[model samples]
Target: MTHAERAADFLLDEARTDWHDESLWQVRGKRDTIVHAIPEWEALRQLGSDIKDNVLSNLDTYLEQFERQATANGVTVHWAKDAAEHNRIVHSILARHRVNRIVKSKSMLTEECHLNQYLKQQGIEVIDTDLGERIIQLRKEPPSHIVMPAIHLKKEEIGQLFYEQLGTDEGASDPQYLTEAARQHLREKFLAAKAAITGVNFAVAETGGIVVCTNEGNADMGVHLAPVQIHCMGIEKVIPQAEHLGVFTRLLGRSATGQPITIYTSHHHRPKEGGEMHVVIVDNGRTEQLGREEFRNSLKCIRCGACMNTCPIYRRSGGHSYDHTIPGPIGSILSPGIDLKKHGDLAFASTLCGSCSDVCPVKIDIHDQLYKWRQMVSEEGLLPKTKTIPLAGAGTVLSHNGLYNIMGKAARVALSHAPRVLVYNGMNPWGKTRELPEVPKESFKEWYARTHKSKF
Candidate 1:
């Protein structure tokens, strides 16, 4: 099924859908409260955008500088041109250490690379240490949100998941109780793990360090406790200088979850004493995205997820509906660049409300890009004939004033007089979910002309 079909299925459970909508709306509300209080929020966003623009313009220079500094600080750096290379590099590191099990913190880059499945196929066990990540890991599901991995799930669902996996009390659903149980469970994994993998929120070129922001301190625990630490970052994660960190760090948490700042913003400049640290920089179609003039601005994303929260379509449709690693407005634009044929349907998943762009901490024109992708998809002939045929006909008619006026009158007459079965039939895809509007008897032009005849 296409993304729209999957999203339609998600809407079947009204109560669950309502719960999901309210949950994200609440996050958006919190972000508004905090962002409005900050008089410099817009300025920060503009600065963050400008910094990223500069970084992208000279990405090669910044990356080389970052690698030089990181290597000097006793960190090993690996570059991957694509996902396969990224997965191979990570596995090679694991094999070099002869480690079978590893603890991992929240890293969406890993998800994009399908690192967990690849490692598991090679006989490695990867344990997600974040609370939300662990919950979804047990459920064998991808995260619905970047920051809150299992936000789609409720306490009762979590209680059942923990009961089945961690042997927690069968009826316990309290947040504190579940968190403690998970903490104890993950602690054992952390201590026993010989290596750990984490995602980099920001990689500062000037200091040759990486920043990981987490609420649970999972990244720090996993990195510090393990003998080997692997940090995965997309090439776009690099910024020019250390001072730029101040702007992004301030915007990240407040925009994502409305917190003043992340509870723990750990900067790892070097590996632990006697431990090895590896940073894998993966392009995986990022350079291709960067080369696209219209879409390159999407690279500025800090992954704060504020756009996802404010997106009405995203809240109701659910993240999984996008059928991509990262789902929502941002994902809609980025995923198509990775595989136009496979993810072409994602571009049509938005209402073009522009709310996503309005709330972006880095001012990515998400909705505008989504619209642009639609044109690109259609131009590439990726859209199904069902849409293309009708759109082509509409385009032809709309280009001719006489045909346009004739079609408008005919449409109003048919909509107003057609029988229920005829107007709301199987052929009308839109009529399945929503009723056709009550068409007025007269066209707007006809009514206007009649009303203003004396004046004219």
Candidate 2:
């Protein structure tokens, strides 16, 4: 099994833990109730979706318009068509300013492109300022959650890590003291850093300003404090105006953490006094994804992370299990676009629950996209060859009644001799941790033929 598949297996194992699966299912239920209480929530979702759809449809125009406006505001705009180009642009900007150390705000885009590793290779020390991201960074692990990078880790684990890395006393495990210690440590990095890099939540076309949403105010602090600010954003992040950003910001927090709104929605129209600001708009396979009608709606994502929180698979498996920067339902669909063969199994990670679609701030039909990705993956011949036989057999069996009955009889006979572990090990990802059910001695057709069919 591939890393992605292995991650899914681990998550399935986690789900088998007593009632943990039901807890996430409960979260989905609560989310629905909360959203239903707001009369205009659906409308806002529709508006956000339509706005993003419009922006994507005319992306070329909006992108150029944003460039012009941002340039007029004294911001340098750079375009990168893929991950390599994006990393090169950021590295070049850092080199031009002679920046050796930099602080970063939470940015899934950077994670998506593995920016930290790239920057480290260029000899630039990059520190993640987001609390969760910082924890994962210290651990040298990818974030397991989009909103809460270290959600899977308990506070004791964090205390231990802090004790080891920051010279804190072994017993210093209080959330308050831990937060304060992190604050003090990151503050020093922020103050001494020559440059800061942030991910853009939304870039306004009308004013050419970048909008960032954060609860901790780290993004604002990093950008405003640094002598140089570099903002990396996906091409899909552009919106028509600041007013348009309001719609997304409103829905973003509610969906992400069940908050009314994030504490700060910082808009960077200009760099601080004597500082230079640059924005790198990265394609990274997003443009090609936009042209794909079935999957294009995936681009409307606002990264609120509500879907991941509500997803049963994501909660148990955590973000790292997805083996991608952005994990869970959204990552399943997005990863294949970046690397078709290696990441193909990601598409099969979903249970088609549709809760992700329901909680999406911009209303991307994530479940549909996952289904579409599976088909696309199969069409591209990326699925494992060994599994092809059973998949093909399933298709044939389902298509013909005669074959279905014959297969049903053969399955019963096979189950009689098959070890019970084979049921646990075959066809189900859940078998990684849980025992599979025994096949019935007779099919439903067999039962009906002997009893009810006699009357007919």
TM-scores, all models, native as reference: 0.96, 0.89
Q: How many backbone clashes does candidate 2 have?
A: 1
Off by over 4 Å in 2: 1-5, 8-33, 409-456
Model 1 spans with C-alpha error above 4 angstroms: 420-438
lDDT of 2: 0.84
lDDT of 2 by residue, 111-209 (tens): 878899999998999999999999989999888777777777768889999999987779778999999999999999999999999999899999999
Best by TM-score: 1
Residue 61 in candidate 2 has what lDDT? 94
* Residue pairs in candidate 2 whose N, alpha carbon or C atoms collide under 3 angstroms: 144-319
Give the clash count for each candidate: 0, 1
Candidate 1 least-lDDT 10 residues? 435-444
> Which pairs clash (backbone N, Cα, C closer than 3 Å) in model 1?
none
Over 1-456, each residue of candidate 1 has an lDDT whose tens digit, in order, gives 899899989999989999999999999999999999999889999998889999999999999999999999999999999999999999999999999999999999999999999999999999999999999999999998888879899999999999999899998999999999999998899999999999999999998999999998999999999989999999999998989899999999999999999999999998889999999999999999999999999999899989889889999999999988888889999899988999989999889999999999888989899999999998898989899899999999989999999999988887777788997787888998897677788888899999999998
